[model samples]
Target: MTNQNILAVDDATDRPRISVIGTGYLGATHAAAMAEMGFDVVGVDQDPRKVEALSAGRVPFFEPGLPELIEKHVATGRLRFTTDIAEATAVSDVHFICVGTPQQATSFAANLSYVEDATAAVAKNLTHPGLIVGKSTVPVGTAARLRLLVARHVPAGVGVELIWNPEFLREGKAVDDTLSPDRIVLGGASPAAEATMRELYALPIAAGAPVITCDLPTAELVKVSANAFLATKISFINAIAEVCEAAGADVSVLADALGHDVRIGRQFLNAGLGFGGGCLPKDIRALMHRSKELGAHQAAGLMQQVDEINMAQRQSVIDKTVVAAGGSVLNKRIGVLGVAFKPFTDDVRDSPALNVAAALHLRGAQVTVHDPEANGTARANFPTLSYASNPLDAAIGASALLVLTEWPELVDVSPESLGEIVENRVVIDARNCLDPERWAAAGWRVVSLGKETVVPAPAVRVAALV
Candidate 1:
């Protein structure tokens, strides 16, 4: 008969009625995940086409297990899609705002126009007041501001709680990470709101995932701090790589040795091409920008080095290319493999691989690039770069091959076949993702970061006795 019991009704009603807003990569994936966990989820989006696609068991992008998950849920009547915001608000007690908040131009602050619009829409149509949780990454003070807005607009004496539960899903492994998260974080002003969160993620928590609870500010910080730490880890290795390059040492070996220590167990210490994708690079810069505006100039200054190191790593790749291409890229045929910043994701935002590709083209090299999942997105960004269907096709008649992104396909490429296609067998492994011995044995000259060029053993000739 009370509001708490009203929200609790979904528990006994055979699968909780759930609604996820803004069904892009994050939302669509989360919606599918809730359904997989036996929740009756209604996925809502402003775009009728996207809603229709999900309703008909279609996924807009290329996630490995997403389409099948959506299909499985839709068949069981436990999942559905909707373009009507009010209908979703009416049926679901928990509405997740999963919209994007990209950085605003002319400043370092996050652009929350989309977040505001999505939040206001959810506020206007409240059937029975429950919880409105934010899963979007945003500026530190956003949840508090949104909480105030919800209170101002909600019906008199109606109980609607706002919670901040930031998402930590990596682009490629979103589904697995969602279903079996290493940790669950919930932040809100009310204990009741936190209880609902615990219930929602109860399965993961019971399965031995650590659940951390705090107020709004601490939860907002956990997301940004985690990103900042990852950025620092990457830059730290790249900085060492610079020293190795100057001192004639192998960074790959140094990384391996250093990684053996328990403190630095080598998750993000890749020595080549730096960090990128949808997060990392942008998030750190934005956090620094926000700190400076908050008068924390000293903290902002430290991140300046992190930013400098990542940017410099990209330039280092370009510099290596110029040196490898006979001291210039002037009219040389250059091949670029893997345009996605990292492997297994189609997102190309601030991607170092594409940046290198564009830079190589600017330096007058006839650049040809290829990636399995990212070529379409890459072409949209850099239409001038000649894109090929596969890695071998990209190297056809090229003077130099630049391994920019570390897709697994690049490893299995036959070095002998590549030798026959190029003007000379030379490769710059910017990612250090290839084996030096294999490529060298195929008579291809292999150049890589923080190490000397390797010379393969010559083929033994059998002398004929006449």
Candidate 2:
């Protein structure tokens, strides 16, 4: 059948009415994208404020192009939001559990309470035969455990099947990732459950995104494994970056040479402040914790190193900044550019930029931060630090500047323009995104990760003999 026909049938029978639980980054984007794909989508969350904002076509957080998508679908009546889980279960035939699985406060393990609670709520309220798909990043074997928990609450003879369909959306490119994903993965117990998922992702699959179907545990492993590999790749380059720093070799040049090998392919090869934000850090730690629980201590040891290397990059920035300030930032003014974990989003969870900024602040530096999109979020997370409206504002009267997150404006900023504002001419390119030559020509001392700062020749002093 044609795509048009599929939507018509769905609307006629109300067969694929979709409900998304936990309207955070992943859930909100999925709900809006599903609505845009012509499904009647109801986004359910425990926070009434979030539901109200989403219902009014406003995205609570920043993701480029998401608010527009949400606004368009809300106007067309294809999308809505509510805090009512009962209302959601009553109307929707497919429930997507998109709740978060944050790392526990005191441990490396993932706190599965959110996932379990979301599953239990759906199971208790699933009044009709439907599919419960999990799109959250979770530990391996979580799907098998949830299946048993869900089965007990679901009514006998009512087909409420749990499926593992983990999400791989990047923060900045979430919309594109959801609409035209690199691939789709679905894990289910039976053919019927897989069939439901296939139909649900038919649009993307038709758009040339391949689908991988497997059993529950394998499916759960895919998301965490991908994150682990990416984190390892980042840390590997960073580990090499440390070597380059010690040897005075340029990591950027090394990464370029390494990129030529087709097998390596240079995606996450850039050595900088290292990987942070919601996914990589917590996911890898959770994987390590799960590996230990499963008696795979050797595997966990490697991941533990990955975590350590990632975190060490942040401290490296702190150490470099202190060195740039001549061993102390005691009452020195410092400018910081970019506080988001990465560009194009306002998520600051485990952000290296903020961590570095906070460390500097604690060291008695008057730190002024500027992020094109993350100032509000960063302010909430680190209220003691000062914030600026723009990079120039952040630079004004600062003894030194640190480029933390590589937002485009910060990357393209003219060193001359920034030089005109600061008290001293010093910059630390923590992200390795700036041009060393350009900053040096502008008469700034540029410090970069994995590269040494070159001191310019001293001006000849001619003593006049009277």
Candidate 3:
């Protein structure tokens, strides 16, 4: 009654039929990617609306390249959506639990209700042998706990094995990350489970993605620890940016110089409005909470500072905006560029950009928010703030433009065009995304965090010698 035996009984085809439970950002993308990998994928969700959207070859969420992939697979009949978990379990040999582990309403701990419920649903319907893979980010001991839960709920004749395969997908680059993952980590107790995971990811493996096999706890720790490190890296640079502001040093220049050192490669060295969105902030807090529960108070203390520093970044932006508006933004129109946490996705969960816009609006500033893909979600999140159709619309008649999120369109925005629309030729690069020299050349008074305002002197007027 091993996982291999279960697969043998259920899947007669060359490729295993995969069921991805929970069709949010993670599950939907995983299902489509698995389908593209040649497995007939059934995406399961409790929400009928989401299923209908996917069934119609439309991605409910905004992810670059994911819609096309889902459409391609759905058109070819390789991918399908379902609201019935039992129906999905009946057909699939492997179930990937991609449910969300959001932060608890009253605590810093991760709420694993979705993960637990998904596990129970799949386990209850496992009439045949199946491999259950946990792709959700959970507490370190969750996989072990879920293994026991699955064992208890699985039917008498059915064989079920649990494996922890934490997903490391960034919101914007999920498709590329899945199709050609940097590395794949599989944590399982049995050889059958590991072998099955390896076989499942054979395409990515053959494409040169490294596979790391480990114990359940280690695998769970890897995901949280990676996020924690990234959060810390971001906060570390932001902390330095704070010093740079006080000491009159340029953080961008410092980061560029620091990036040259192979030991301190600058991946998360951005010193902007700080890290937010779904993963970094919540994952770090959950890690800290879990560490405290495990009696590691010192480690938790360090992460607490990281969280504090990240939060401080948003306040710093607000303070700077207030100063830019002559100590009050009351009745002043402020343009906000980019409301999504980052570019190419519409996720605004705890987005710093939206938070700043909301804060400004609360302080009586007329905030007009703009984002390439996230305006809809941002508007939903912050109804008080007015949304614009485009960057120029956001900047039109505004006193000062605030570049909050580093969308590529916002990054490459022409200051001249923006200046022509705005009442004041003032631009605040809160995200440090725009080139200060370019804005200066375009007759803008450019302001950036952690850098002195050095407007290039208007090209020296040369009087013709008659």
What TM-score goes with each of the models? 0.94, 0.95, 0.96
Instruction: Give the per-residue lDDT of model 2 (tens digit) for 234-288.
Output: 9999999999999989999999999999999788999999988999999999999
TM-score, model 2 to reference: 0.95
Name the runs in model 2 displaced over 4 angstroms.
1-15, 456-466
Model 1 alpha-carbon miss at residue 458, Å:
7.2
Winner by TM-score between candidate 3 and candidate 1: 3
Candidate 3 on 1-466: residue-level lDDT in tens?
A: 2455757743355667899999998999999999888888999999999899999988888999998999999999999999999999999889999999999999999999999999999999987788999999998899889888987888887878898899999998999999899999988747767777777889999989999988999999999999999999999999999889889999999999999999999789988899888998889999999999999998899999999999999999898788878889999999999988888889999999899899999989999988998888887777888988999999988888899888888999878888888987778788888889888888888888788875756778899999
Error of 1 at 147 (Å): 0.5
Candidate 2 CA-lDDT value: 0.89
Per-residue lDDT value at 232 in model 2: 97
Kindly indicate the candidate among 2 and 3 with the higher TM-score. 3
TM-score of 1: 0.94
Q: Candidate 1, residues 342-437: lDDT per residue as tens digits?
A: 888887889998999899899899999989899999999999999999888899888889888887888678888888888767888888889999
lDDT of 3: 0.89
